[model samples]
Target: MSSETETFSISGPSHLTAIDWKNTYHRRCVVASLVQGVYILERDRQQNRIGSQKALAPLWWNFFHFQLNNMLVDSADHSIFGAIFELKPCLNAPRFVIAFRGTLIESGTRSRDIHLDLKCIVNRLHKSSRFQLAIHSIQETIGLAGASNVWLAGHSLGSAIALLAGKNMTKMGYPLETYLFNSPFVSAPLERIKDQKVKHGIHIASSVVKAGLTVALKCQHKQSKPQQDDPFVVLSYWIPHLFVNPADHISSGYIDYFAHREKMEKIGAGKIEKLATKHTVESLLSGAILDRISEPLHLLPSAELTINKSDSTNFRKAHGIEQWWDPTIHCPSLVYQYRY
Candidate 1:
């Protein structure tokens, strides 16, 4: 993330409201679940549990509708992993999904260590030749062919890269949907200026001092471009439905913040406040999330997320991609709605 992206400069993704509500909700949920599968495989890779061959057997075994098309391993850095898959939601209609894996948490003697360095964000934002070449290679290999709809899905650090990729692809005239879970703030400039943890455990131990240095190096290397021309700015205009657990310290579960709700309220007021005046942004946001996915709001009773109170376990579970998306354990509902 950069100073230019202090606020979401780009809009969200195309609303899924144009489609059927039930199908939309199902699609969003399924996409998120499939994305979780990718994260699982990465975790397996990190733990050295992967056997003789690397396969998406986990995803295939877990999600029947999702078919792995190709595994995208960055040739420059084998550690970076992503995948392209085809999903048949209903009626066997295929939806192409491009997903990126998040940071691998390395188990340590005390706390877990994040494997992917945050500096990658600065490099991605600066459009480093190496990063750009890798992205171009992915595009060439995937070569969006006969794809009626394309979605960019990622969790945590992967979400940051997906945000950049989605915004750029949209600017290039692609109508792409996106789903990000427990996404970290993408602005390096903003993080440096704020000097605060935007997301839980995200401001790397070294980042406190190095963030400024990272920004300075980027500033010196790249010529300034108009803010509007910046992809992140474009991303702010598109409303991508970001699924975050309210208890997720890693993402800071900012969605439950009163200020965040207030901001969302303003966006609804301008567009769909016709439903009711008394509804808070949190409530309507649930509806909007459903609508964007073409699903009518069900307004189900609120549910409690059963997370252990211990710090490490809690953080791990709250930030867990699978736990966050699990309907049985975590359901999207207004905090107030549930309490009352």
Candidate 2:
């Protein structure tokens, strides 16, 4: 195995018993790192020209007492996008974890993954075969081991897939515990602003405009009001764990996303914010032009947002999956629960 794959061992202590799985922070860090192992496993598969002498899956998962149950393959490019890890009997972790790898820029699957990324930008990722396979795998896992014993995890593009799958399963009355590391939020990089006042001002202006548009669309019958049991409304009750880095623009928007909602409410604009939160600019524009309603993949009604406060100037390092597992980083988190 290459050195890249070797890094998977650094994710946790040499022995499983050394760490406390009951600790929320430790568990979150470990789960995030296991997702990294999936990334390495896929990378090794893509680069390995000859069959390896040692097994790859066991190398990473066995340390955590989890066996690789299945490999999630991308039908389009024949790339390994994710894997299902089944916990050894009597382990403290979830019985099964379904993990997806993000866009691997240097791998052969790059083109296919990037295509899906584009699809995600326009909210068409659900129609892709990869996502279909992911959801199917989740459904199968739920059937085998109840939802409580299942976990969903991913990074970047993979995180987006996990998010969608989690949402669908939640709508079906099965909500799985999910860990999304550096999940891409397709929107303006509002979190990039250095000045708090400027950022807050822009957020207020944008929220008001979006709320106004949403109300106008409803008045003109352009957008119909969602019923009481709408999937998005039901999704409010299924809160996933979202890990983000303010230094990474792709995922950092989530910081502003959740923060702005609270700010709007404090200013007595809660009603407007609520209306705007139901829709996205991309979805509304696409619905008008294409005559089809689509929800933005990144928007979530509720989430436990964990922000990594580590100072990293490099974008690659900032957005990397490895950061989540780094023991030295300072991570502050908050839970955003939306009430219907």
Candidate 3:
């Protein structure tokens, strides 16, 4: 991955196919999900909780503690989705701090950060429900486990889910603070939100989405872009020829796309395959779909927080979010047009 871009999650039209996510977040999640899948969702005994590395309580502690330390943690998988969330420590916030990461639909290198290559990897790359369900599981676990001091956070795909969950909980009168990292798509449909419900105490948060100029440089390389029609066919060609730097995979992506295209064509219409193979990363980067423009599925957060160093009023765009934050402390919330 590049210097500033960090990876997390995704799935998309212009995404790569040969990207290996094993060293990525999905690996951690699939392992955890398998633990839970076969797990007897039963609580561990007080003594049982002591030594088991696979114990659920310790896992929660690790999950939350990672957040407390401002570190990102991965999510579980079934169709094998992945996510990242940073749980901040709650000194006296009066509530628990819970985090949920979003998915990337084909954004980065096979084993790199989403921030570096947003188009190489892919997952629930939109504001969709299946992604929402992944976070819903986390919520259910949080309540059942009695892990208090929760503040929800998400990086990319999970960012949108975190925003919506927090906003919905707020409207339902549930006290919560929402933070979305550098998300691409708008979190929720505007009309669905209520007026006073969002205004009272539940605050909407987000940051501005920005991009680095070099991203344009990477995409601008014509020789580096793919020229194939099928991803599966491309993989057939490149899988045997491994490269040293992951960045090289971007140029090699054309081959992966070709193979993936052929594979999908065997079953489906190869719609995404057709789209992925046709364009150069440079072309997409030149437009709105930058390979590193605020995480393809991430949201710029706009939340409120009063730091002791500076008051919230002093902060212009108090909750304005950017792509830099792995799981930003600020996020966007849907506030509908007010009605009398």
Candidate 4:
């Protein structure tokens, strides 16, 4: 990430509160599970994970608000469902998943080695991948005598890999689905091959907020204006702002990006030089990543978000928000509500 970005620009995406000014997505009960991110789930009427100073006062990292615990959570179904990997037993599902970790700390490895390993994230996302299909079966392979794998799902960076798999699945005629990151900081979306694949109906990677809208136009999903359900494609994203909010920064697992978070808090990010989320702003340099579709190369460095001001209650204070956001774009801004 650029030090230039660290100091000044308040993000347009972070300022956002509502996509459709007339309708707030958080108001309607959506079907997302807050298994570990408890605090952020019950946040303000707005999607911004911060509730109140009372709820926020005690923590060392005020912006680090999404709550996940070293505490283990269990599911009783004859299977294992988790953040990194899932193992299902005796389930007669046709597909299996070969999920790979994006980036994890591995002692004694050079940064070069670390970047190479991160490609495993994409390795699992190849389309029509028998290997990916076989990943979910590992659970049954060890536990049950014979259990088939089911569908595949990924969030954020993982979602991008899943999308890659969805495309291959389209060619091979397999059922695939995914939920990718919104404008990932990793790589730009593959467009030409993707745009032409519309009619064949490949497995699609749904979105929390459509990755296309938030990415640099160069990085928009590989398709033209997207439809809600095109298999092998990115999904729709609504509340793009919350993720950029200081509160949602910690939500994505794998703390490598935490370095920027830590730096931003200690040395306040300068003014919002430009909003990266609304359009494609170049991503911070890939800290340690090696991928075919890396997002950094195609970033624009100045994009604008389209938010509705009436929706926001305040202006953001560094150390208060989790993501690096600029206040000028079109969204709910904390500038009005906060004085810190």
Candidate 5:
């Protein structure tokens, strides 16, 4: 057997051999493979090697009995950012999956992706053309297959795109099942602080400042309280599944963000926590400057946060999409549900 085949042979569970959709691990492994397929697809295209076995779209999708239905191309850089896979007949799986590839720093799409990453950091990703295209593709998919039959999955920057798109669709009354792997959380690296008391103190201070700012903004603008139908409030019920490694600074902030909210509630500061959790410093600043409220891409109200407890000390390995599918890793998770 060729080395390439050997390398990918044990990548993960095969859908042809086992159909266990009820298994959370099995579902994670399959969805993660589909996301990896998008990465390989883009890599193969960039290298001018489309049909190589390194392209796991065919090998993995064929094993899962899914066929590529469409390629989501980025109009700015002409890079393939995502794909639509439809299950073949006689398969027991999601009818359709819209999977996205994350940033490939070493590839041709590096510049375009890095630009989008910057946009994400500033809470301006929603205005980007790539994200607009993603939203349109998802809308078209739902129109054709209905939202219940479709699943959304992405990694890193791709996960941010998926997240924004999912939020948009959910507001329009189409809640999707989303899987976000190592999604970037733009914030200070509080998770890196080893001293628990110091980290907690900083978190409390940050939350107080944010909550105070929100109250001041409301008083200045004479704006009424948010209604029950407000998009952010409505979004609290549509929880996405988030996978992160504690060692990955880019994504680990989510752990701190959600945990701090719980701590605030425990101390009878739920009101401050509520306002603070709904807005980020970047989003608040952008909103004040532009005279329009902007939602931060990473400020999720609810999520099934899965933290991988793998012993790998490498940043690249910790933030990698492949780790989600690694059967040997330990992933303990908690559901963070927001209450009004």
Candidate 6:
């Protein structure tokens, strides 16, 4: 019993077993799936309203105000979906889960904000005006709850929004964690276009230039108004857990690749060294197989539900949120087997 609870300052891959990392990965995956489910629900309702020519009301506000007051208030500026929960005493801490809805189907009433999507890739400040307003709404709700911590989660485009929002929120002195599922590469990844020779060359050159600029910016950041606990540094350490499926081309099948790289960097920080070398090792042993290979040796045919059966016309299903939480299919066995 003493050995199990022993404390030491030693750090390395040796200190952490494969099972520990597996459990952590699976746990985060489950949370990501739940977040994706929330986004799916929000998206579905929005689409339904669009089809019927009626705007979808922000239903989360009802729950938000219900816990605080009996009177119902309608506010239309809140574009993002979010919920507030009243937990048991042990979990009495003020908590929030802000879920962002994915891309609009036709951009019928949202054309002006479309440019923000592309702009966000280059400038984090270029978030959609809707998201900007949503942040204000979130802040108001947090004030009402006296929230000490926030969890930002989203799927697809929402994931991108969540990342930007989380970054900004942390800068504003909020303790937050972001869980992103099948998040598309807001900034292009070098590996994403490796197969395209022309594009790969262009990406490589761009990467070189970007690296130089990044180094310069870091140097400038260090010299100008250096605070002991810089928010950007805090944000860097609070790495967003990103979950991706190999078939999820919206994420370019490389989001997991980048995430794996960052994960290794995080584990190997300071005196700690990463144990797993290959992404497959982490994915297979950790039971977080977000990536699916086209061909697997001795591969038993997984249930059809695991794979999207939709035609090309239904690209949305290809990046479907449903697949993330489908216990009968994509979900890892460990998730459903235990309480998590």
Whole-model lDDT per candidate: 0.45, 0.82, 0.31, 0.26, 0.84, 0.41
Can you tell me which runs of candidate 4 are displaced by over 4 Å?
1-101, 105-114, 117-149, 182-340
Q: For candidate 1, lDDT tens digit of each residue in 106-193?
A: 3420121142434442232324332364356446534654423566777776665665565556556553566666666322222223
Error of 5 at 156 (Å): 0.1
TM-score of every candidate relative to the true structure: 0.54, 0.93, 0.29, 0.26, 0.94, 0.52
- Residue-level lDDT of model 6, residues 35-133, one tens digit each, is 433443344444564332242222222222212121111133223344332322224222455666555444432443355455544343333465665
The runs of at least 3 residues in candidate 5 whose Cα sits more than 4 Å from the true structure, single-residue gaps closed, are: 1-7, 10-16, 52-56, 89-92
The number of clashing residue pairs in model 5 is: 0
Clashes of each: 27, 0, 88, 66, 0, 0
Best by lDDT: 5
Q: After superposition, how far is residue 83 of candidate 2 from its true place, in Å?
A: 0.5
Q: Residue 310 of candidate 6: its Cα lDDT? A: 27
- Model 3 accuracy (lDDT, Cα): 0.31
Task: Compose the digit string of candidate 2's lDDT tens values, residues 160-263.
Answer: 99999999898888988999989999888777789999999998888777777666655665656566555568898899999999889889999999999999
Q: How accurate is candidate 1 locally (lDDT)?
A: 0.45
Best of the two (1, 5) by lDDT: 5
Which scores better on lDDT, 4 or 6? 6
Query: Please, what are the lDDT tens digits per residue for candidate 5 over residues 89-197?
Result: 4344678899988898855898999999999888888999988888888899899888988899999999999999999898888999999999999998888899999
Which stretches in model 6 have alpha-carbon errors above 4 Å?
1-95, 106-113, 122-127, 146-149, 192-209, 215-232, 252-315, 328-340
For model 4, residues 302-336, the per-residue Cα lDDT tens digits are 11222232223432221122222333323332211
The most accurate candidate by TM-score is 5
